[model samples]
Target: MEYPDSEAQLPLPTLESKPEAQITKLPTRPRTVFKNQLVDSTKSSGSAGLANKKCRARSLWYALYLPQLSNLDPSQQEKYLNQLAGLMQSVSSTVSFHPQALICEIRSSLKYFAGIDVIHQKLQLLLEEQLQQWGLLDGFLYAASPTVTGSLLLAKSGHNTLVYQKDNLRSALGGLCTDVLDLDKEQRRRLHNMGVRYLRDIWRLPSNGLCKRFGSNFVNQLNKALGKAPEPTCNYIAPPIFITSYELPYELENLDRLLPIADEILAQLCDFLRRRDLSTSHLHFSLLHEKRDHTEIHIGLRQASRSQQHLMLLLETHFNRLTIPAPVIAVRVEVKNFDAFFGHSNSLLETNSLDATHYKDSKLIQFIEELQARLGEDHVKYVSCAAQHCPEHANMQLDYRGSSKPRLKKSSAGSISRNPRPLWLLQDPVRLNINKGRLFHRRVISIISGPERIETHWWSGADVRRDYYVAKELKGSRLWIYREKGGERGWYLHGIFA
Candidate 1:
């Protein structure tokens, strides 16, 4: 409560008068550990495995950096934290302890466990398990996430498995002995000299000069018990990453025109990723397009890729409805989650696209993407099979653009036939009504081929059931035509030789 109550005082380990703290520890003696799904316990808690292996397991894991280590030397604690960090992915802040010690909290093991008790127990076991090698501080383990308040800890005594409820967390610690607060000997003497005692008393201080002068240790402690502040049992992770942004020159409604700008920033992101050797698995794209919709496009990558082109493709595809909400203003791309580029090690199969070699393809892609800029990406590409036995597969399409690129794909038949495809087929199949199969379209049927059956899709309503004839025309050329044999009666030029 670091406030002005006229009775302002700091609690110390050896109170000058052996006075109790005014603060109230949450009652823990009667607490029954119950699972609280709200808290993600498994990932940091290492107790689940122990429970699985042994019927009952109890271990105390205390998350302390070098300074927090009451027993170990400061240098030794730092050395151990560094060693432990190699094995554990931790998130913590290390500050020099007054006694010249350091502190770190490792919590990567909690996700796999079920409850906090199990996690706490497992962490305890881990600390004790490694005490012989690392020389820990009594192998005691405390549970809590970091809080905006302070780095103070909320600990559960013993090594037994026990679940933790969201509401019960306060009581479990409130009932704790005031000693867990661990006021310094000097601070204790100072407080005891004033005849003050108990966490409840010190916590009740008003917020004003006390907090302004003494700092946040008091408020932070209360926040820890109240849980408004997270006391995570984590180790030192990385510092929070920062992203840069620029103001848009103008509002951009077209996803296409924004490509260059996006490319520019994406290039920057690539550089950052390369430097960090990281790949963004998920990203958030903010588009302040126009007066219509200032949208945020959240994309989950099918595969984590740091490639500029791949990311562009995904973003371009997503702006399907990226109409300018307010005539387009600015755009920002932020990474929500990132992972180290796992397999970016040198590989021959990796696609290489330097500025010089890939310039043409990049330009081509850019040009093809222009339509997506002008008109929403509704009709970029269409997929239509050519001849039944063609090698080219689906023809170039502008309508089937939005079909998502699948992760796993199977082969499909060719759109055009491989039977000597023509160099220049008329857009509309030419009509040369044959007289009893007499050819005209530049060639005669010196040799006639079978009348293969062709059918149209029924659901689309443009049904076509025809018998196609491959005939060498009166001239020295070959042609293809389909004479509707079922519902319609007409000879239409389906295709012709080059």
Candidate 2:
């Protein structure tokens, strides 16, 4: 059909005007499989449909560059990097960091935030507040692209471009200056001598020529920027530990003066655990003094906890017992041993409730912890029965942090024995004088039950062979006496029955 001149001048219907259903109903095309696809794609002019499909399959990386970060000290740099990484988690789950830059994968977060634009707006607002708080008046630079290196290159080049599709990446990055490549002086001179001033000029050259001239490393970097090669990423993971330090305005020798500073650090640790739903059972405090000396204090809990009030109480107890050798110039707190926090059932029940067994256990743990803090941790001990026949090896002593219930192992002699044993054993057996074939201690002793022989550890160099008997003293007191079988062959008092 032929149209009039005026009608012919009218604009044609555009793809943007197509209905959603119509677009969905269109036939799908098979994906193209190219040999040396990474290289071939860079050389070919592909269709937009293929590009959109490729882009949808790849992750979108957003790079943030803070120029002021380089001027900050290493500690300050790490602090700001952590702060920015935490903020970026609101927009994306996958975040990676460089010296002064942060790269996050936004493709997965796009659906949650509705679109890339909304994500950008939310992040921009958050970043503005953070920058203001940090006193970074110079602000920052950012860019989004299909590849990590591409986004970083664009961000560092100050382009602030956002290219979502892999197909458009080449042209979008073509105009950037060669300096963004971070070339060495020699490399830059060579590029200049070769009249390669822009990235596009380098792209126009043959891959083999560039590899031979600039080395394969530079060529690989270019490929990574254009989405031709994959780049490895080190995603950020929040550490399980919390470490914070405070510098006092002046050295203070009084222990009471340090409580406030310690309280502040404890509060921060509690907040850190609360946000992560974690609890810690171990804490370390360092009191830095003059002359590069430090006093270290360690706190151990019977149960994992994150209560700031309880921590302060423990800290106060430690402070009461501590003797400051020198004035403290700073205080540093560290907590390692983190555990997943679960709401305690006992916490929801009354202390008197029959089901509040855990509450009673917690009370016991708290008491033990208090004692540990008051006395040194080494002074507090837990005694448990061991699995040995010898009295010396039958029981063991452990630190206060050991299990409340002893794990008993059955011995070859069985769980129960016919022989009656004394409740108390002496450190060293006392020799008894034999008077007319009778044993005598402070007073005369008579055998109540016959001898029970015990012989063990024959394989060891130090062997023990003895015959023990339950005896009674002249005053009606119970006595445990033993007679050596091989060596000494004399009667001795070993223990007393309670």
Candidate 3:
């Protein structure tokens, strides 16, 4: 009848809606049964250690980016990585009412890895492998929990995970030490003296008395763990601005030589922060060299301060480790931090805006460009250091911002104390003649003096000297002259050979 009712058309599939962004941090209350359960579970299983790896859980973190880690300058690398760690640390401090300690949306990663857990596992593995190669084994971990919040909750709960899923969470937490409840040290001891050493003991206590004894925070954590109260989750503020770097002259393969260059560019960026009296929170590095392998490193500052020295130390440590290939072609560094100055005072150092004389980064940018021109980028350097004991090694050479560099030190050929330095030491020395205080450039020498002089490299067999007298010629020019054995004395241009 009437086409089986007008409303009876076939149903079409509609796509399900998904969250717009990944949940970056998760908050899980680690109280009662679930708390101790996580502890025993972790110690009983080997995977507990695996979970500690930073990349192991989803709700706690999102996409893990290992950029062209090899190409960045070390300073940037350290800052970047350390910042990541600090942010994760921040998650561990979430309030008890916070839900899901960490939540990294797997909507996209799920597409590539099969499932959210798989994606999380992959990232954790990546970090573990890389950190191992970098010789960093301590103070890092990643794990899974029944809820994204629980995993993060378990992290700061104590260095272990006794349980992971919602059902297992309670039993896993029963044995957890009371100290994991995010209480101050004094509060922890107070709980201890009150016979609430285990999370279960605290969980079983009367809520009204618990709150009265330890304040509302303790009761609040219990409520969140028991799913009675809502745990607020706050996303970390995404950086509004960031800066990065790259090195050219890709062929500069030596680590010793490259360290200075890396340091210099990073310093320039740090100096840029000084203009605004700003300090950065995070910095990262990528080292892209030859060979297929690349490396990325990072560092984070607890308090924002534009401290060049602090940042540099972290960078140098990582850089010093690299087993650089024969020749590296380039390096890159990125700074991922927002602008934060000490105060809003109007001093020149306190401003983040640019001025007429120079923009914040104008001078450094110009310097780098000009340096690339003359030194061909490859030969030019960004960093400098004092040379060593050898006169030839006195000062490390940096790219030109100033004066001409003297290529040579003192004579290695002679032991002469006063440095029988030529008026103009030449790559190719030209012998000269002198007679009675007049140079014989245009004529012959008229006088020879009693031999008195200095010589060098006697053991090494190089020898030369003379009772050099002021030389004269028909032209009347002064000359540096030395006598030879025979009667025939030859004269050649020396000082002004050019």
Candidate 1: segments with Cα more than 4 A from true spot: 1-276, 281-284, 287-292, 295-331, 337-450, 453-465, 471-478
Task: Return the candidate ranking by lDDT, descending.
Answer: 2, 1, 3
Candidate 1 TM-score to native: 0.33
What are the models' TM-scores?
Answer: 0.33, 0.53, 0.38
Regions of candidate 2 where Cα sits further than 4 Å from its true position: 1-234, 345-355, 402-406, 409-414, 434-438
lDDT of 3 at 342: 53
- Model 3 per-residue lDDT at 478: 46
Per-residue CA lDDT of model 3 for 59-175, tens digit only, reads 222323332343567775655465444343322332122222233333223334444455545556555665566654423433444444444555555544534334456666666
Q: What is model 3's C-alpha RMSD?
A: 16.8
Write the candidate numbers in order of decreasing TM-score: 2, 3, 1
Quote the positional error of residue 403 for candidate 2 in Å. Answer: 4.5
Question: Which has the better TM-score: candidate 1, or candidate 2?
Answer: 2
On lDDT, the candidate that comes out on top is 2
Q: Is candidate 2 or candidate 3 better by TM-score?
A: 2
- CA deviation > 4 Å runs, candidate 3: 1-117, 138-143, 146-149, 153-171, 207-371, 378-398, 401-498
Predicted structure 2, TM vs. truth: 0.53
State the C-alpha lDDT per candidate.
Answer: 0.49, 0.77, 0.47
Error of 1 at 91 (Å): 18
